[model samples]
Target: MIKPSSYCNEDDGEFKKEWKNDSNSSSVNSSTLSLHIAAYENSSNSDMASTADTEGLKGKHSLAKKWKNAKHPFFGSSSVIQNSFEFTRQQENDKVSQSEIMQFKASQKLLNPNSSVNHQPGEKNMCLFTLLRCSDLVMQKQRNPEKKKHLLVKKLAKEGYNDIYSNEPTKFIYLGNAGFVCGVSPTYLQELFGKLDGFHKLHSFRHKSYAFVEFKTVEDGKRAYELYDFPAIEAAPKAILPKGLSVISEFITPEYEEELLGFLNENNEDMKNRSVLHFGHKFDYDSNSAFQKGLDIPPILDELIKSMQPHFGTHFPDQITVNRYRPGQSIPMHVDTHSAFEEPIISLSLQSSINLDYTHCANPTVNTEISLPRRSLLIMKGESRYCWRHGIRPRASDVGEDGELVPREERYSITFRKIRTKPCECPYIEYCDWNRNGVTAIPSNNESARQVEKTYVQQVYEDIAEHFSQTRHSKWNAVANFLDSLSKGSVVLDAGCGNGKYLSTKTDKFFMGFDTCHNLLRVANTKGEVMNGSLFEIPIRDSVCDAVICIAVIHHFSTVERRKAAIAEITRVLTSGGKALITVWSIDQKTDGQMSAYAKMRSNKEPTEMKQENNAKLMIHDGTDFSHCDMLVPWQRSSDGAQFFRYYHLFYKDELDALVESFDELTVIDSAYEQGNFIVIFQKK
Candidate 1:
């Protein structure tokens, strides 16, 4: 009765009676194919329905939550491990036919030689099942040339065995307990299976329909993810994973050798020793026109060159480098280690997009090739950029006639780098100061990690229409909502005005703003005026405006004194009992709610310090104010919303009452809490 996707072995009989080979088995197979659905249905304590009208809790990622729960505990739970194996064996007994077990085990051994047993309960079932970076573990692999793989291939399908490389064929391997691991040759096993410390292979693929992969430790599973993402396969561009485990016979068409030969002859370099083709490579950063390769690079590529100037800052000394690719030529595994990457490498893909193989220098074993779509601007720094390297691999199909990875295709990328920066040092650096050096300043784990405190937090911003705004899109929403409730010609002023975001809202032409940052206001040019001003001192007439609105501004002040001064300004600017709609984090969440999580993390000896790349300081120092720190202090836990604040100011019912009583004129009318957000609407009486 076993339908095979359960991947449980035959001897153990993991499939249940009546359910074995049941029509429901196909549905279960389809369900297992989708890890998110499986996790949502199977996992306990997950909130499938949203009833609590928590303000920020609206649409969170359910898949992310599923991975955390499914992966973290099973490795430590012996009971879970035992239960998984027992479940597998029972399922095998119920459904999987005996004939499939032998081929499945052989395939398992070839892919991953290591196998062991578990007496533990509630064991992890799949990867993509657990790994955070990996969305799913149900990846299908191609067969090796010798037909040695014990694939779960459909029996009637045999299409393209003649075209596969005789030397190195495709083979599927096991990635811990719940996931599949694939390797090219015997040598790839180390890279594929070596990272899984606690995982043991379930060699007996009961159904041979799907393999049951188990992890001994969640860390092992994470490492597996760090190593074996489908994108990582792009690291070897020549090797493409076709869409799922389908019959290549049905999909693949025989290539005419003469056509391939003609294309090969056109290539300037000899192809004798090459294993794969590369479609992406920067032949010349300075090539303003096109290369001798004579690729018809898209005209829209002009925008990519222009975008670099903004992100690379003044440190970008030269025009960005550009590369174009056509089907069948791919760059191999290599590093673009140049001083140009002083900040980070920002690339924009246009026209022909490609797959980028990003691999860590420290963990060379870890790699992934995320797809770069046309017109997608990629901001890659730190681990995926400086600490590592990125390149593009070429293949035959850019997109199949059906519009998928066509085994090879044409692709192009524009990489804008900041070659000139405060001399920082990298391995390639000569003698220099912060301006002259580059990647070397970045602390390595081997190096004594220095505490890189932020003089000011660098908030990632976006420009909707000439006005700077948070890419998160929340601030704009908050501003628009505030403006809609107001009367026309209301002389409103945005205190702590960041880049005139509120002014960009479609409000009546009477909105003015004042900010601590003069540079931000210079371009604000609102209908009234945006002057350089602080909350402690308002340059405006008293009681001139009917309402004052503040959003995501008060959280920057770490201490209570700064908060009080800011509050006093709001009260002073208001007319007697004038309405003030403000959104500050609820402090109640920080005290009783957050303190425990922080204490728990610190108790585990969490590292106390961190570092950062200083692009442009978000907040300029007036030379007298306290320095700003990164959103999260090491060992201090704060949700994304609370990270900017001293603590989550989740106001308790009593706290709101106390504030209202103290102010006397201000009354809290309604409040709602969601996720990490607290929305309170106040009315002036």
Candidate 2:
């Protein structure tokens, strides 16, 4: 009978001595490895057969029953089938040899049960369970000692037992209710838990609900199981699990975490389209299949993956995804397509910790939330990797087991996967990409609104973005010279920056640009940091930019206040000593001959009337007609029969200078006419 104790404090040396004596009873060769343990604690043969049948392992179970009458204590223990299962590597020769050793040991122990042996008064020693499923095949191989290994391999593959040949299994022990200790420092927990003899590595996942601790040996694991009784923390109520010595804790130094965080920050860039960069085979949404794109994985990433081989096995990841999330951002719930990638996906987190929600596709109500800590590596395999869908919720702060957990900074993650070479034969075919039978994709409402906004002004540029880019290839000499004069590493902002024409000018410094047109921004993205946004409202930190350039943009405003507002916005974003270059279309640039006809076309209303205010004249285009300062400029696409009109407020040289200087905080540095435009450089007070 097995004695269940509250604390089993046997030391490592005692266990080692017992194991050596037990192992001495048999000297088995690698050939007889495919042995099965046929005994159970309380289950009858019929009960075991029912279980095997339910699991679709009928053949394996029947083979094991054939050895039930064998007189070996090692072959009849309940632990053999439960705690003693060993994970075999995919290496073919080693797998066969190891399988044979299991059988040889079991046979030797059965034949010599009366040999001199030492046992803990009443405790049963457990033996590792071998490939019980391959017993029948091993018997045949034994009969014909000269049988080739290839034949056995072919038989095993045909029987659907190949999945067991997984990569070197990761050593992990799951901790229940880790969320109760979110306030506790990981380093403190690690130190407290490290007191247990064999604890080597420790990690905790999202919301601190659970954690995994690795040990050096099986004896250490059993010792932890018996001695470390988890106690409930102060945060948990009666409903929470009681904890005396919980199996949750581990240490990661602050210096190590900071190094990883710095790496991610250095590589991050503002993205306007997809939140992540997909490398290797790109998954096509339209066709619902993966296509091989000739992009190679970065060498640095390859080195990082290689460094993780000890923990995650020797699986080469072909697909890599890099994602950066700021505050109030999130990734929607979705599962990796079964047909697209292999099992055991790894995600490395950096900078900020976050909670991840996991749900079963078949039963959505049964959900699990895991907290991912900074600089931690998360491995998803087996049931967690295949059957569930995982995602992060959109929120600035997450409510943990105790209270809210607010990230002090941004978060980034790199997800790595090995693309499957062949068709997927996974059991969850119903939820796979091949059919999407049970899967439902939910479109983002926020993204839909953004798409609609893009159609207003963005679609116009999208129609002629490439052609317009061609006409403006050469940079304006004066603006180019000013940009070149700036010191290296000076932050620059391109307000209403389209196609990123001047982006490459600042090489050493960070250059950021924004536009309402997504199509134009896509082209600009190749040169610098460009995002989809509006000029009237800048999406950046206050007073952070060293300089700003708003060219051929202010003239597009319909009202004088709007134009003034645009200038004020630029001033607000500039540093104290920062300067800005503002330009508008010049009415003087047009020939006098065309002025009469244009005047007639715009003869509907009077020119803008204004009054002096705040030491400078207020430039108001209120009640102005469609002619004079306001006119619609037409553009024709050479590729198609489409024509579009753009609004423009032509500014005289004096008027352009006065409008900019009207802001009390701005001091005009220079004003001039250059390249059919009125340009003015001003500094913020």
Backbone clashes in model 1: 88
Q: How far off is residue 655 in model 2, in Å?
A: 1.6
How far in Å is the alpha carbon of 113 misplaced in model 1? 31
Off by over 4 Å in 2: 1-459, 590-627
Off by over 4 Å in 1: 1-94, 97-100, 103-479, 526-528, 585-661
lDDT of 2: 0.52
Q: What is the C-alpha lDDT of each candidate?
A: 0.36, 0.52
Model 1 TM-score? Answer: 0.35
Question: Against the true structure, whose lDDT is highest?
Answer: 2
Model 2 lDDT per residue over 353-440, tens place: 7777775443343456666667667777766666566778666676444333355347777777888788776654323454332121
TM-score of every model versus the real structure: 0.35, 0.30
